[model samples]
Target: MVSVAMDAVGERLVSRVERLRALEQALLKAGDRGVRPAELAQRLGVRRQTIYRDLQALADTDVPVWNPARGRWAVRQEQYVGTVRLSIHEAVALFFAARLLARMADEHNPHAISALEKLALRFPEPVREQAMRAAPLLERRPRNREFVQALECLTLGWIERRKVRVLYRSARGRQRHPYVLHPYFLEPTAPGMAVYVLAYEESYFRQFVTLKLERMSQATLLDERFPERDFDPVAALQSAWGIMWSSSPVTVRLRFSPTVSRRVRESQWHLSQQMEEKPDGSCILTLRIGHTLEVLPWIRSWGRDCEVLEPPELRSQLAEEYEAAARLYRTAATADSVSGLRPSSGRHPRL
Candidate 1:
């Protein structure tokens, strides 16, 4: 009698484990749109009461499973259950990357922060200790709250493939324009972690446009849905240098100094980039892309370390900018001299 009772207890434990595993799998597969208890029970070959008990067990473990609507059950955010082993170096690298992302993430959106928290929790004891000590070394700037809110609204539109109306302030001028947009994707832009929405304008030319979220005053998700059959954001950006796309493609050739050649070659600047190393240690990079304006600043960042070899128009534009910058500096120096406003030692005159 005692042996039979012990076997019964062991069987009950195994059954519970199996049921919990099935419940977790169901929740993971459901993703943002959560599975109903009835569906989960049916899929797991269990009763509704058993599924409810399993859900309660998950809740006890602090899983973010919740009912998003009246009857729809979904995870608040996607989560995984697994142990990820990372070396100290990998942990540090991930820590810094997470720090940068956290700085850029929307204040209203807790997804990135929650993910980082989970990652930190999974770190080995020694690495986690080191990370905690190094945490103060990383500085994070507060994100733009208003822009983050706008991003949340746009994200919903993109996820549902729904149309949205945005009151956007133009980048060229500060003019406000109302646009009916089919939000497709969000991309991070450089200089800073600025967010832009890649959407098809429904009201105007039915052309694609990238709107900066910071410039948007409001974004409202509409009830209308759009067919995403042929819309490929990746294909659309294939020829783009950065975010801007152009119908006309241009081949840009640049020569990098030997000092900066290795740095240039180390990074994949574009999909169509081809590099040729010269005997002198200098290198030439050629890229077949459109939207020269987007890459102009990047080229200029190398300064005297880089020279435009092809596309005479881009070279001329760079020359003009250099000349303009030099003129401004010379004017500023002259004014400083005339006004007896010579800066103190180690400090240059301000423009």
Candidate 2:
């Protein structure tokens, strides 16, 4: 009868709604690794054509679903409406990460602040209270306004894929130079972050140049767009020891005494590092990296406890630096003696 037909129609509508919800949830879970049509169809217990139609329906409803790569479909993160479920450990981890980012990020950067706010809003009341209590314990440094402005300008350029002309101060000669740059990405550094760009100079075609945000005097976005070349940030920094990327890769070996062996062995210092423990409670750490300039100070921090086992050039450099330091100290001691000042006493003896 007509009544039976109505009941059947209502059931079908309910089933359709359930299916759509399932599809959306699946796409959200897929994340960066997108789902395939066939995979989705199998998972949803539907035909491939049916899944395709559902995807088109979702798109029509303003859901941001697209093929990130050929044959793979994913829901864009921004369009996901599901709550981000985080366990206590994950929440705490994110809280610390946000705190660190807030400290290092420019004060004027709204995105970082907004993200932290959103994350805080997501926590349960108890966790939220805990986070509020912990907030005061974190030490946040004041933002550098000049650096913030430069960062914002460069970020805009990067997002638009536009070229930027900048007046940059060189770290080596302390000279300012004008250059046109294709803003690529911002890389995080020790104390803060560093911005790397593809620079186009009159003498150079396209060179990878690292610029400190504070060092840039001006950044003017240009209308000219650059082609998105195949550049991998990881590959570019594979051999680099910290940020000094000019030199060729060299295998460096250092022997650390027993006093510092445990400290050295506990942490992974470099990606290319290999450690060997000796019977005498000492250890040898080997690294294949580029440019030893940045790492020289780190090596020197270990002082007499660390010995350069390979790469005679590095050994010689360290020896020269140590000798210079020793001479300076000796000269200071001689000056104090000539001034009629006892080496151990607090005051100079009266003539």
Global lDDT of each model? 0.77, 0.76
Off by over 4 Å in 2: 1-88, 102-114, 124-143, 172-175, 191-205, 331-351
lDDT score, candidate 2, position 230: 71
Give the per-residue lDDT digits (tens) of candidate 2, residues 284-337: 999988777768878998999999987999999899989999999899999999
Error of 1 at 317 (Å): 0.7
Q: Determine which window of 10 residues in candidate 1 has minimal summed lDDT.
A: 133-142
Each candidate's clash count? 0, 0
Using all chains and alpha carbons, the TM-scores for the candidates as numbered come to: 0.75, 0.65
In model 1, the number of clashes is: 0
Write model 1 residue lDDT over 1-351, tens digit each, in one string: 999999999999998988886787678678667888898888889899888888889878777778866766766542434335787677668877776765554333455555566557657887666545433322243556566567777887787677888788776876788899888888775544567888889787578888888888777778798777567777767888767666678999999999999999899989989999999999999998877888887898999999998799999999899999999989998999999998558767899
